[model samples]
Target chain A: MKNRIITISREFGSGGRTIGKKVAEKLGILCYDSELIEKVASESGFNANYIKDAGEYAPGGFLSSAFSHRSSGPNNADYLWTIQYKIITELAEKGPCVIVGRCADYILREKADCLRVFIHADLSFRAERIVKEYGEREESPEQRLKDKDKRRAAYHRFYTNMKWGHAQNYDVTLNSGTLGIDKCVDIIKELY
Target chain B: MKNRIITISREFGSGGRTIGKKVAEKLGILCYDSELIEKVASESGFNANYIKDAGEYAPGGFLSSAFSHRSSGPNNADYLWTIQYKIITELAEKGPCVIVGRCADYILREKADCLRVFIHADLSFRAERIVKEYGEREESPEQRLKDKDKRRAAYHRFYTNMKWGHAQNYDVTLNSGTLGIDKCVDIIKELY
Candidate 1:
C-alpha cells in the first residue's frame, strides 16, 4: 500500500465519500474529495463552489454533449476538467491516497498503480441517507438523487468517453446498501 | 450465512467459474455451473450441449432480439430461460449455494437473499487463461471472448430487461486479472 492509489466513484448518497475517507484514514493516507475542488479553484481562478458543482457534474445533458465539439475550444466544464485532471495527477504523484469522485479513477487509469472502485446502493437506501446527511429539501430525496447521478454521469461521459460506474472499468464495485459502510471500507482496504 | 445464496455473473474466461467453485468449497456449499445445464437438460429434454450454449448465451444478436416479439410461442431460448428460472428458484429454496451465470442473480434478485457477484478481467489476462484452459482455437482468443460476451449480454437483456454485468445489479464485482483468482475467491467469501 506504499504507493498504491485508490479512486472511488460512487452513486449519490451512497456513503462512498465517507467510506473513502475512512479507508484513507485507516490506511494512513490522504483522502482527496473536497480538497480536489480547492486545488482546481485555486489553480483555475474559478469560485470554489462553482468548481465543486461544475467540476464533477456537467451543466447540461445530451444536447450539450452534441454541441460540445463546436470548435469553441473547451467549455467551462471542460476547462474545469482539464485543471482537475492536472491537480489530481499531481496529488497522486505526491503520494498514495484515496480520491473520491471527480473522475479520478479515469484520470489515473494508466499513470499509477491504482485500485479503482465504484460504490453504489439501492435507491431507497440512498434516498434515506441523503435526507439524513443533507437535511430535508424542497425536492424529494429520490428526485435529487436522480438529478445528481444524471449530471455526474454526463460529466463523466463528456470528459472520459467511458460509461460512469460500469463494473468493467473498476477493480471492485461495492453495494453499500447491502454490505453497509464499515464493511465496504474494510473490503476496500482488504483489496488495496 | 444461513439461507444466503451467492450468484456469480462473469465474462467468459475470467476465472469466475473457478473462483465460484473454490468459494463454495471453502464455504461447504454446492457450486452450480455445469450442474445447472445438466439439470435443465434432464428436465427440458434438450441436448445438454445445446442448453449449455444457449441457456446463458443467446442464439443470435440484435436482429433476433428485434424479431423475438413474433406471435409464435416462446422460442427455444426463451423456453429454456423459463425452465432455468424455475429450477434456479427451486435450488435456492432447497439450500444456500453458489449459482454461476444463467442470470441466476436476476432470477433470485427478489426471491432470495443473494450476494450477487460479477467477475471480470483484462482481455489479455482472460485470453491467456482461455488458451491454457480450452486449448487454442482456429479463431483468436480475443475474437472468441468478444463473441461470447456479446451473446451473453444480449441474452441477459432479452430475458431480464437488465444490462448484463452492470455494477448496480450486483453486491460485489471482482477483477480477477488484478486481484487474482484466489484473492477474488477470498473477497467473495469475506463478503458472504
Candidate 2:
C-alpha cells in the first residue's frame, strides 16, 4: 500500500469522521477531517472561520458565473478549492491517509492507489444518529440532515461535476448507519 | 420492527449469503437464498434447473421484443419473476426474513420497513476469496467475478428498470471484502 490514499465522501450525520478516524488509527496513519480546515487556513493565510464557513455552503449561481468569466484568477471559492486540492494531493504524496469529506474523492480521482468511498444512511437512521449524538439543536435533526446533505451535494457537484452519492463515482460505498462506525472502520482498513 | 425484510444484493464471492444467513440466525428468522429457487420451482412447476439457469442469465433481446408484442401472457422470464415476486411478498407478509438477491429490493420497495443492502468488494479482494473458498475452477476467478456481476446487473436492470449496484437504489451498501464476512454479518444483524 505505497500510494494508498482513502478519500471519504459522506452524508451529514453518517458518522464518517468517526469511521475515518478509526480506520486511520487501525492503519497507523493520520486522518484529516476538521483538521483539514486548519491546514487550509494555515497554508493559504485565510481565517479558519472563513475557510470553515466557505466550505460549508455551496457557491451561489452569481458567484459561479462571476468565477467562470475569469478562469485565470481564482475567486473566493475557487481559491479555497485550489488550496484544498493542493493540500489533499500533497497529503497523498506524503503517504497513506484517510480523508473525510471536502470532496477528497473527486480531488484524487486520477491517483492510481486512491480508494474513494461514499458513506450514507437512510434518512430516518441518520436523523436518529444526529439526535443521539448532538442532542436537541435549534433545527430538527431531520431538517438539519437534509439541509447539510443538500449543501454537500451542491458543493460536490459544483466542483466535481459529478453526482455526490452515486456509487459509480466511488470505489466503495458504506452505510455507516447500518454497519456502525467500528464495522465501517474494519471494512475500510481491509479495503485500503 | 414490524414487517421487516432485508434484501441483500451482492457482488460475486462477497459472502452475501453468509451474511444473510448469520443475520437471519441472529434474528431467529428464516433466510431465503437457494431455498428461494426450490420454492419457485415447486410453485411454478418449472424445473429447478431451468429456474436456476434462467436466473443466472439475462433474457435475450428477441425474447424481450417478443414479450413486448403480446403483453397478455407472461413470458418465461416474466413468469419466473412473477412467481418469485409472489413468494417474496408472501414471505414478507408472514414475518421478518432476510432474502439474498433475486431483486428482492425492488420487489419490496413499497414496504415501509424493508432494508435494501448492496454488498460489493474490490476485484482483487473478491478474486482472493473465490480462490480460497472454491479452489481451482475452469474460469479464472477474476473473469468469473466479472461475468457474474454482469449477469446480475443485467438481470436486475431488465426486471427492475434500475441500475443494479447503485447506492441510491439501496438503503445501505457494504464492502464485505474489506470488512470480512463475520463483521459484515454483525453489521447486518444490528441493522435488522
Candidate 3:
C-alpha cells in the first residue's frame, strides 16, 4: 500500500486514543493524540497548556463576531487551527500515521490518502468508561461526556462546515464501547 | 452474561448477514436472517415466497391508506411485521441469539437485553462486493446497491420510526468495508 493516513474523530470516553495507539503499535507507525498539542505548541510558539485548553473547541458567538471585523488578523481559535492544520498536513506528508481528533481528517482531506474514522458509544457506556478512567471528581461523567462531545462537534462544524460525527464524512465508524479497545485496534489494523 | 440478543441492521452488500452468522457460530447461538421469512411464513400461514417478497418492505401508499380505514385488518407489510415481531420476541425469550435486519433491534428493544448494531460500507466498496458475490448480471452493481440500501432504510424507518443506519439508534456501528467481514465477526463475538 502507498502512504495511508488514518484520522480518527471520536466522542469523549470512546477509547479512540487507545485504539489509535494500539493501531500505530501494530502497524509500526506513529500515533498523534495529545502529543499533537506539543507539536503545535512548539511550532506556533504557543504554550502547550493553552493549546490543550483551546483544543477542539470553537470560539463563542460573541468572540467569533468580534473577530470578524479583523478577519485578516485571525482570532485565537483561528490561529490555533492554522498552526494545527499546517502540522497535520506536514505529518501526513511525512508518512503513514494515525491521527486522533484536532480536525486532522478535515485538514488533511485533500492532502493525503486518508481513511477518516469516527468512534462513538452509547451515552451510558461512555459515562461508565469516563467515570472509571477519569474518576468523578470534576463533573458528573455523563454531563462531562455530553459537554465534550458538543464542544468537539462545534469545533469540527466550525472548521469543516460539516456535521462532526456524520457517517457521510467518514470512511468508517466504530463503537469502542461495543467492540473493546483491542478489538477496535485489530479492526483498524486490518484496514491499515 | 445473561441471555443476550444481538440485532444487526446493515446496508446492502455490507456483509452483515455473514458477520451475524459468524458471531452466532462462535457464540454457539442461533442466527436468523432469511430464515426469519420461513419462520414467519410457517407461523402466519402465509406462503413463504410471498412473505419473503414482502419482507422488510412497507406497503405502497394506496394499500396503506386502504388498510387505514380497517386498521384491524393490517396490510401485507403490517401483517408480516406483526408475525415477525412475535417470532422475534419468542426467540429472544427462548435464549441468546443473533438476529439480522427486519428491525429486530426495535422489535426486541423492550423484551430483551439487546445489542443493536449497524453495519455499513462505502458505496464503491459495497458495489464491488455485490458484484463479486452476486455477479454483474443485475443492473449496474452500484445502482443495485444504492436501491437496496434505500429500500432497507425506508423499511427500517417505516417500522421503527427511526432512521436506519443512524449511529444514534445503534449500540455500535462498524464499517465492514474497512474492517472486513471476519474482523467484524470477531469484534461482535468479543462483545457477545
Candidate 4:
C-alpha cells in the first residue's frame, strides 16, 4: 500500500485540507480535491454556476443533493458520478494520489492500494479549529464537535451506505489532539 | 482531585488488571480490585468463596457451587445488590481507588469526586490475551474474543444497569489498543 490512495475523511476545520496538502507536497504527488470538482464541471460542461452551487459547501448536504438530483431524470447522476469516478480512477491508476474527500475512496474501493483514514481530535481541538477558521464561535466547543460528528456520520452513511468512524470502517482512526497533525502524518507515513 | 475515584471497566483479558495495577502504583494509591471483592465477601458473609465467584463474574454463570445460605424467599435481588453496594460506597468514602471491573462508579454516583472510565481494545489484541491466559490457541481466536466481549458486556450491564463501553456512560473512554494502559492511566490521573 506504499503507492497508496489516501482518502482522509475529517471533521470540518480539522486541518484535513492542510494535512492533505502537506502529504501531497512531501510525496511529490498531486492531491486531487476541489480540482477534481473543477474537472468534473469542465468535463460535463454543466453550467459552472450550477456546479459551483451544487458542488460547493452544501447547506442542504450531500445526500439531499444526491437525492434531489437523483430524480432530475436521466444522465444527471450518471454524468456527475461518472466524472468523479473517472478522475479518481485515473488518479489511482496514475500510481498514487492523496484525495481529500468527496467519496473518492468509495469510488476507488476496487483499487487494492487504497487506505482510508479518519482523523479526529478532542472537542476542544475541533472547536479551536472552528474558532480559528471563523474567528467567531457560534456554538460551544462540545456542541460543535458532537453536531459535526453527527452530520458527518449521517452524511457518509447516506452517500456511501457505510458506517462512519467505526473501527472496521477505517484502516486507522487517530486522535490528532494527542500529538497534532504533524505526528499523525508521520505515523501514517511510517505505516505506509 | 488528586484523590478522586476512577472506575475502570474492562474487557476480559485485555490486560486491564495489569494496567490498573500500573495505574495505581504510578498514582501511589491502592487499587481496590480483588481486595474490594474480599471485603465484600467478609462483610456480606455470603461466604468469601461464593461472593468472590459471584461478585462481578456472570451472576448465574456458576452452575457448579450454589450459595450455602441462599438467602431468599423475599427481597433476594435486593439482598444481593445491597452487599455489592455497601463495599462500593465504603471504598469510595475511604479514599481514591482504581476500582476495576465492578460498577464502583455507578454505586458512588452521589459522590462528586468520581471519574468513570471504560477501557477497550480491538479483537486481535484481546484474542491474544485469551490465548496467553487460557493456553487455548487451537480454538478460533475470533470466536473467543467475541464470546469474551459479549459475556463481559452482558455481565456488566446486568449488574450496573447501564450499557458498558458506551462513551456517554463514562467520563473517559480510552482505546487501550492505541494507547497502552500505562499512558491511559496517566491521562486519567491528569484528568482527575
Q: TM-score each candidate.
A: 0.95, 0.68, 0.78, 0.57
Instruction: Please give, as one word, the docking class of candidate 3.
Output: acceptable
The sequence of per-residue lDDT tens digits that candidate 2 reaches over residues A82-192 is 899999888888888899988888888776377788888788888998898889899989899888887787788788889888765675687776667777777677667
Candidate 2, after superposition: displacement of residue B52 in Å?
Answer: 1.6
After best superposition, candidate 2 residue B124: deviation in angstroms? 1.7
lDDT of 3 by residue, B106-166 (tens): 9988888888888888889888888888888648988887777777777776777888766
Q: Per-residue CA lDDT of candidate 1, range B91-141, in tens?
A: 999999999998998898888999999999989999999999999999999
The C-alpha stretches of model 3 lying farther than 4 A from their native spots are A22-29, A47-50, A59-76, A109-116, A128-140, A167-172, A178-192, B22-29, B59-74, B110-115, B131-140, B189-191
Best candidate, TM-score: 1
How many Å off is the CA of A112 in candidate 1? 0.9
Q: Write the per-residue lDDT of candidate 1 for residues A29-48, one digit (tens) a residue.
A: 99998887887898899999
Backbone clashes in model 3, listed as residue pairs: none
- Residue B174's lDDT within candidate 3 is 79
lDDT of 3 at A173: 75
Q: Which stretch of 10 consecutive residues in model 3 chain B shows the poorest summed lDDT?
A: B61-70
Which segments of candidate 1 are over 4 A away from where they belong?
A59-63, B57-63
Error of 4 at A11 (Å): 8.1
In model 1, pairs of residues that clash are none
